[model samples]
Each structure stands twice: as structure tokens, then as C-alpha cells.
Target: MPAIKDSRIIILATNGFEQSELEVPLNELRKAGARVDVVSLKEGEITGWDKNDWGTAVKVDHTIADARVTAYDALVLPGGQINPDLLRVEDDAVAFIREFHASGKPVAAICHAPWLLIEAGLMRGRRATSYHSIHTDMENAGAIWEDKPCVRDGNMITSRKPDDLGAFVKAIIDAVEENASARVAAE
Candidate 1:
């Protein structure tokens, strides 16, 4: 596996993110030695949604208005019913995701986070997976939905739900290391 020690990752989210969805990758990626930032819609912090209610608050490292896509190697979008739904409507959030995906960097969208991908116009002809609840929404947006734990197509890494996070994170690290290797080769 990749250590990802030199990677700079950004987790873009707002309030109501899935608790484990954000926390797991953040902790695991950091343990792999990556510098991870939790970028939200504002400063201070953002709260996550747990099983039945609001969960822990993750500190905000930066806001979407202040972040630049070129500064990071990958982007993680954690999902909950509310997080992506709210973010997808924000013009800045959608635009940033679009630009980042266009840059060909790894963009991981777990569960409902795929909604952001749809809003960014990135799902056309892409193979992906997401929380079962959004199957129709995903298909309508032009994605080829697969019923798997994780689906990696091109630069997009997506997962079905929390139980599939292990595979999701692995795919992300693999993509990051692969992209890094490609860049080094080109140089």
C-alpha cells in the first residue's frame, strides 16, 4: 500500500456530514502521513450526522471560498443525507468539485456524496456506487451504478456506505500513489 506521506488531501464538507465517513478517512490518511484538511463552508467547525442524530464536530481547516484545487492531491466528500444535499446547491461547492475533478486528481465521494458529483456534471458515463437510497438519483445523472462496496472509475473513487469504508480508503490511497507515480514518470 502507499504511505501517502507526501500527499496533501482535502475533505470538503459542511454541517451534517456522516460522522464515520469523514472521520475514518481523515484518521487513516493522516496515519499514512498525509496532511489532511477539513475544509467547510466556514471557519471554526462543522458537525456530522451519526446514526440517529448529530454527531461529533470536526474542526474546519479552511473554507471553500479560500481553498484552491491546485493545492491538493485529492478530495474526499463524506456523505449523510444532509451534507451533500446542502452542498450540491452551493454554486461555489459545485464549481470547486467540477474544477477539481477536471484536474484529474482523485475525488472520493462516499454514500450520498455522489450527489455532489452529479451536480458537478461529473457522472456522465462514469461507473460508480453509492448509498442504496440514491440509486435512482445516480442513474438519472448518467452514472452506471454498480452494487458494490466501492467503485473506482478513472479518477473518481466512490463507496456505497460506511461498512465499505475500508475498501474506499484503500482505493483512494492507491489512486493517489498511482497518480503521483505517473507524474514522477512524466517528469
Candidate 2:
């Protein structure tokens, strides 16, 4: 896929985010020449959750209070049981995501991160996928749930789990590039 050289992507996460899910896509996006930012509920650093324990800490670039949906071309939500679970209840985080979705920009989530989509009420009637444990939650929230590695419906992209990171990241890049192209054509 082509690189989103000038696109700006934001990964909205917090402490307890699945380590690989957040790091892999963040690295991939930056490597593809996109400017990626990590936005969380608080300032400073957010820690990650490794397989069975707490993992590395990542610097937070922006807090939900200060992030603007219009400043980014895409939004990513990385999943870990605690991360999304915590974020779903934070009104600022959910509203930030909702505004981003309404902007028609690519909004991608992996694993349990789709929980935020459910909270934001953006999954209704959209085709999506997430960690198996949340399949019921997603379905109940009105998403057409699938068991695929990656699924893209309009500007929303979702993936099953860490194993699907490669495909998930690729899908996000593709969506951002497509959105960029469309804007250029419109201009």
C-alpha cells in the first residue's frame, strides 16, 4: 500500500493498552511517513500491558481535553481489557471519538478497543470485528460482527487482535490515503 506521507494519525489510548497493539501500529504508521500522535485521558506517560504483566511506558502527546478531531486525518484505538474498558466510561474520550467519526475520517480499532466505538454509538449498522470476547457486546451494540483479521466499513476499520496488527495497520493506512486522495480530487 502507498504511504500516507502527509497524513496525521492519532492513537487514543491509556494505561493498560495492549502493548503490541499500540506499539506495532504506531511504529508502522510512522515508518510509512505519517505523523502519529498518542493521545490519552491524561498528560505525561501511559503504560502498556504485556502478555501477563505491565509493560513499557509511552509518552502521551496530547490529552483528550486538548485534542481536536479536525487536526488529525485518522484515529486509532488500541485494545487491552483495561484500556478500552476505562476509556468507554470517560465522556471526553468517547466524545472525541464520536466527533472524529462524524468527520468522516478513518477511525480504526483493534481487539477490545471497539468497545469505545460501541460507547460512542458509532458501530450501529457498520461491519466490524474485535477480540472474540467482545463479539456479543459488539453485536448487541448493532455492529455486523465478523471474525476476520481486518474489516473496513466506510471510514471505520476494525481487527480481531494482536495477530491481526499487520492487516489492521495496513487497512488504516489505506483508508487515510484514500481519504487524502478524495480531498485532493474534491479540491
Candidate 3:
């Protein structure tokens, strides 16, 4: 069977998300046969940040107001300096992330995306990694921050930056497949 076949993955992002952080994982997950959706803070579309400038826009599959954590099997948070910074301050976004984490589903965050986990109060005691610039913020929030390319702690997975996309995406697929297998075994 394909890894994560029939699994539904939701990518939570907003304007100014890191381009590759979102696109690469989304593409990889879909290639692994998972149904991936881009859920944003607003409807219509969200633009990405390509290093120094705004990048291409991705169509929104669902808005925060309509996204329900139970509808999907996993969550993805793509980091850009502005994206997670904006999401961390949004009550609905933070609530959604908190609820998702509580569900015990897989959550893969890359680059600055871990900021949302910190804001949602889910970082404490978990081993994770993110963009080097935010190491202190992550540590102060009670997370065991590492400088590795990718780190997985239970249902949460994280990566340092774009260069870690391969490892990051693989972790996500592995987590999803493991979760699926667990569910089947339980049944």
C-alpha cells in the first residue's frame, strides 16, 4: 500500500508563509497518496514568501472558521517570519492548533512554524526543531529545542529549514502511516 494512502492532511497557512515549507511538504504528502488540503485564515487564496519576495498564491481549501480538526488525519504548519507570527496572535488559529494537538494526530511543523505550537501551549516537554533564529523562543517556551534537520516527538514532527524538507516530509508520512496502523490494530 502507498504510504498514507487515503489519509487526509491539512496544511494550515496564511499569507507570507514560507514558499517551500508549504509547497514541498504538500507535494510530497500528495505523492504519497494522501489527500492534502490548504487551510488558511481567510478564504479565496493565500500568498507565500519566496525568500526575499512574495511568491505564488495557493488556493484555500478551507478557512479557519470552517476547518475542523476531526476532519483530517494530520496537520502541517509552514513557517515564514510573517506567517506563524500572524497566526500565533489569532485566537481561532491558536485554538484550532490546540484542539488538533489534543486529538493526538500527527502535526508536522517546519522552520518558524513551531512558533504556533509555542503559542498554542503545546511545546512544553516536547522535542522539536525550527529555524535557528527562534531557538531561544522555543526553549523559553519549554520545548527541548534541537539544531537537527528534523526531530520527531510522539505525534509532533519538526524541521529546521528548507534544506530539511526531504527528512521533514518523510517524518510526516511515517507518522501518518504509523497512526493509521495503530488505528487498524486497535480496531
Candidate 4:
């Protein structure tokens, strides 16, 4: 397993984000020694959507408008039916994701989350997987869609749905750890 040590991780989401989808992977990242920051569409706090009810609130460290792509090593986009769908329509969120990808930083998205990738136009020529319903959208975006637990292509990783959280979190951790190790070796 990869220990992040001092690596910095950024999670981007908004209200209605899938509760466990964000929290589980985030907690695991922190446990492995990564410094994780939660960002949102606005400042203050954001609520998560549990299975059929409201979930815990996560603090917002920065608003999408003020986010800088170069400040973090990795990015995570959590999904709920409404969260990423709303985010995909936000210009700042789309630009932030685009910049992050252009910077060659690891970006992980799960469930309906890859909708944002489609909006950012970063799915072209990449392999990804998401909730089954978005398979056509992903295919239309030029991504080679898969029906696997997780699919990783270069700095991008995608998983099918909330149930795939285990594989989702593991993929993010592995990406972060791999980057951390590479950075350490270069120093």
C-alpha cells in the first residue's frame, strides 16, 4: 500500500453528493497520511446525500471560483444524481477540472460523477466507467467505457457506482501513493 505522508489531496463536490462516496475514500486517504481538503461550489459547508436521507456535512475549504489547479496533487469528484449534474453546468467547476487534467494530476470520479469529466471534455480517448445509465454519454464523449469496478487511464480513474466504493477508494489511494512515491524518488 502507498502512504501519502505529506501529499495533498483535494476533493471537489457540492450539496447532494453521495455521503459514503466522498467520506469513505477521504477518510482512507487521511489515514494513509494525505492532507485532504474539501472544496465546493460555494464557501461554508455542504450536505451529503445518504442512501435515502440526508447525511453528514463536510466543511468547504475553498470555493470553486478561487480554486487553483496547481495547488493539489490529486482531485476527487464524488457523485450523487444531483451533485455532479449540477457541477457540470458550472463554468468554474468545469474549468477547474480541465486545468487539473491539463496539469497531469490524478483525478478520480465515481458513480454519476464522470458526468463532470464529460462536461470538461477530458474524456476523449480515455477509458472510464460510471453508472450504467451514463454509458452512452461517456461513449458519446469519446471515452472507451467499461463495465468494471474501476478503470484507470493515465491520471484519470473512474468507477461505476456507490457500491464500488471499495475499489474506488483503493484506486484513488493507489494513484496518490504512486505519485507520492515518484515525487519522493525525484527528491
Inter-residue clash pairs, candidate 2: none
Estimated TM-score for each candidate: 0.98, 0.98, 0.98, 0.94
Model 3 over residues 1-187: C-alpha lDDT tens digits? 3359879999999999999999998898998889999998888999999999999999999999999998999999999999999999999999999999999999889999999999999989999999999999999999999999999999999999999999999999899988888888888
Alpha-carbon lDDT, every model? 0.95, 0.95, 0.93, 0.90
Per-residue CA lDDT of model 2 for 71-161, tens digit only, reads 9999999999999999999999999999999999999999999999999998889999999999999999999999999999999999999
Q: Per-residue CA lDDT of candidate 4, range 148-174, in tens?
A: 999999999999987898898888888
Candidate scoring better on TM-score of 1 and 4: 1
Candidate 1 TM-score over all chains jointly? 0.98
Q: Roughly what TM-score does model 2 have, to 2 decimal places?
A: 0.98
Estimate the lDDT of model 1. Answer: 0.95
Candidate 4 local lDDT, residue 148 = 99
Residue 146 in model 4: lDDT: 95
Off by over 4 Å in 4: none
Candidate 3 error regions (>4 Å) = none
Q: Candidate 3, 70: how far from true, in Å?
A: 1.1
Query: Tens digit of lDDT per residue, candidate 1, span 57-96?
Result: 9999999999999999999999999999999999999999
